[model samples]
Target: MFSKIRKAYQLFKSIDFEQLDKLSRKVDLPKVMDSFSKLDEKQLNGLMKMLEGGKPKRELPPINGDFYELHLRLSEEDRALQLKVRDFMEREIRPLVNHYWLRDEFPFEIIPKLAQLNICGLTYEGYGCAGRSSLMEGIIAMEIARVDASVATFFGVQSGLAMGSIYLCGSDAQKQEWLPAMQQMKLIGAFGLTEPEVGSGAAGGLTVTARKTEKGWVLNGQKKWIGNATFADVTVIWAKDVDDGEVKGFLVRKGTPGFEVEKIKGKMALRIVQNGLITLTDCTVDESDRLQHAHSFKDTAKVLQLTRAGVAWMAVGCARGAYENALDYTRKRKQFGKPIASFQLIQNHLVEMLSNLTAMQTLVYRLSELQDADMLRDEHASLAKVFCTLRTRDIVSQAREVMGGNGILLEYDVARFLADAEAIYSYEGTKEINSLIVGRSITGFSAFV
Candidate 1:
């Protein structure tokens, strides 16, 4: 013990503040100070070995976004795909994400690079799909969202909702017609489910009416919060049949007469995604465009079941993004003549954020596993969606708290995450709605009226 103490004292004595200040520019000073303060003599010596340009007995590598080492558990092919997607997100998306997000525009230029990843329509069996597991798809969602939520939402609508609708419900001929091009990103698709008045109650209360006509089917209604609708080549519009009153899905091609899309404005979150308010007034579709397997709302629920889990993964990504940024900021930011990270309260905030982030990571990991096993249910997806999004709200808020005023600034990165978390919390299904799903499963009582 005495030798350990002596070594620690020697290590501290050798620490060069000048060197530390230079390296501090690269790392978090507050975090270093906090770690330094907590170290006993022996630990201090070990840290000094790394910090003071000495040959150390032990060395610790840099921290990364994957705190739970998720990549390690993935199959080699899936792991490679994850990295490829991450690189694309960081290189192509990250640089322009904030600018497009601020201007409320999509960067159409990056589509080609994104297409090169060959990740579109992931988890589908054929039509040029990679046919990967749900776990890989969820991880890709996280990777994209960790950089930008808008891009992730855009991808989700296309890959999980729009294409998934066709993949799961369309006839083989319909799949052959759309999936290949969509998989190549040659054709963009959108899913139109929520109506202006319906929102979460869309399943049972669709006001959009589809009337059978001698020519074909005429769709008349409005869809609100429809992602990618403004510029999509095709949209899957869910409407109730006028004759049978059964909810049916239609592939409404763009430029169809009476189908108009007006971009929704004033969105503070997911600003880069071109959400559209679509009005269908006597919009006609061929009988062939109807999704044959979509007999009722039950079919739509299947698409949501797949994407809701991805939303939970996106929530985890958002929380992780905020936590990492906050952690990086707190270590560099100084207060009270030392790094603020040296303060107990700041460390407490970080620990809390990490704990929530870690819990979310573990939960989503297992959630994806269940999805891969074909055991995913509405309640299972809802539990993850509710838990992760709620905890993400808390995590991002605490992340902002630790960063002080800088947390609110967009340039700092945490502010955008904080703002984006709000939209994620409400979209897909509200926390209350999702909780009710779990509530119904466990308690056998439906709380949603």
Candidate 2:
């Protein structure tokens, strides 16, 4: 009798108390328990299993911002890496961005942890890189920008612009000397191609002059708005050859004589990027320091071609982040005794933002596909850049509009997006420039003056 009693006690102890309490509110628990107690061991086990089966299976919430479920297209490994990067960005970069942006400082402390992720130089082969697909790299760019545009820009300069210059144009010796440490994040890099006067016409118009002599190449000119230059270990400087009038690249090491970098101040957007105004007055680089394969502006364009797609991806991320935050804010912010999200006009703004964001995401996905297939033309990436950044401006504007007055506040996050979108619109290539690139491609006419 005692053994049976103990067994019954054990079974009763295993009951879900909260569920029982819920059942008690709707039914007579005492009667239910009395009936339940009469079941023998086998019957009780079956009954428990039946009760468990009646409960609903827990469903996972859908991933936000992937409105078209595009992530399902990624390979399993690629998807896992994407999620890992997303998790890191959410946990490490998101919370700290506004503070750094306000201070206009880079969180140099995050480098070690970020380096541990082993994501830098993601699409490059060997030299400690993952050698992943261009599509995966684009996805990573999107994830980083979704947290902070400055972080994404900084990473783009390092991974796409700086490292890509080396990978595509560097000699085997240069690649062996630089890429491994850079891929590990132990050595930071910068790309100096834009001049104070040569913004849109960087290809054939670089005024920075490089004179080749017996000693080496002497770089003389200024590069403005160079990201990561303030503290980068290496800065890739593009200059017009004094003799040939062709463009060439030089790896200008830090603290090289006459290579002076002054931090660009008073930036309204991408404040944490640490952009620099580089003044290279008779900066002498060894003959060996020149990019072996970069013989002309076309070679330099190859580097730009690789990075333009990343810029487009970053624009998409910025727009998506703003839309997601605005959507969440609307659901919680009350107006007219209900959520603002319930209003028709508010829905219109959200739909516009979402539709644009969705379009940007899909377009970049195809752009990256072209890149992975090695069929990506300059115009293809330019079209994506032109389309994504232009749509991002519209989407971010709608996101700000829906959030009302709170949208302008930095704490709300969309205001940052609002300002950052303007910068992204002009970077890599401006809308007019990119549009002209696409125009020349399809129509066989140069629209760019």
Candidate 3:
């Protein structure tokens, strides 16, 4: 009897006295206590657990941005490489970007690490390149931009604009001299074409002039908004030949006499990329250094068309990163009792963002397929660039809207993506120019000022 009384007392101590008192008013408290005293040890434990609400709520699966499982389409090897690049960006690039972006400086330390990947000149046939498909190259561009878009811009300038100029246009000797080193990233390159005055009018009216000289070609003009020019070992300078009245490309080495570059500052987007304003007063290039095949503006346009496709891929990365981050944020943040994501409006915003992102992804994938098949045209690339970048702006804006106060904070990362999306939208080609290119193809009209 004493043992029974001790067991009952122990069980009574475990119960919430307040709850017991409330129950006493509604039921036979003595009867409940008597029943608890009769329960075995295991049964007592089960009762306590039930009252404590120890059963966990259902857990959801992780949030993955790949809604349509496009990765399933990749072969085993291609998907492995894609994940490798994605991991590298997340581990190495993510931690350094916000710091460099705030100060408006490039993270020069990452160059050696990037070289280790051996991904530069990925699609070109030789010169120590991977010789991968355009799909792989576009995947890499997307991965790099997923962490930070400024890094993507810097890479596109080097791998696409600069090296592509040499690969497509440089002679055999020039290729042997530069391609291997540039592919290994032992030598960095830049593209110099846009000018302070002549931007959209570069094809017909390039102010930069390459005049024939007894020594070589003397290039005289200013090239503005040239990425990597400040530190690039070689810069591909496109100039109008005064003699032939045609545009030509020259490989102007860094520190060449009469070649000067000053870094452009005070940018709100892609701050980590070093854009330079180049001033050339009689900058001379040897006959051998000139890109052999780049004899006209048409050659330059080819390089632009190819790189424009890469920019479209990069824009998709920026949107996906923002959407993923915002989605996770909504799930964690709460306003009343449940996660804000539980609200109907929040789900609508996320679904809208996912819809746009999936469309951009599928479109770029097909764009790369066309490129691999060699069916890509100027209009095809321009349409992708126009559509992707424009959609990216809308996606990032919605991402920021969901985060409210936290969205603008750089720590949240959407802020940087937002700014960099602006740069991508403007660069490669402006929305108006790209749209006109598509418009001209469809309607057979050339409307330009």
TM-score of each: 0.87, 0.87, 0.90
Query: What TM-score number comes out for model 1?
Result: 0.87
Q: Candidate 3: give its CA RMSD in angstroms.
A: 4.9
The TM-score, computed over Cα atoms with residue i paired to residue i, of candidate 3 is 0.90
Per-residue lDDT tens digits for candidate 1, residues 1-449, read 56555554565465598876777689885675555566686667666667677764444335476777867898888888888887888788778877888899999998777888889988999899989888989999998888888888999999999999999999999999999999999999999999889988987899999998999999998999999999999999999998998999999998999999999999988888999999999999999999999999999999999899999999998988898888888777988787787799998998889889888988999999999999999999999999999999999999999998888888888889999999999889988889999999999888888
Q: lDDT-based ranking, best first? A: 3, 2, 1
Q: Which prediction has the highest TM-score against the true structure?
A: 3
Candidate 2 has a TM-score of 0.87
lDDT of each: 0.89, 0.91, 0.92
Runs with alpha carbons beyond 4 Å of true place in candidate 1: 1-61
lDDT tens digits by residue: candidate 2, 257-322: 999999999989999899999999989999889999999989988999999999999999999899
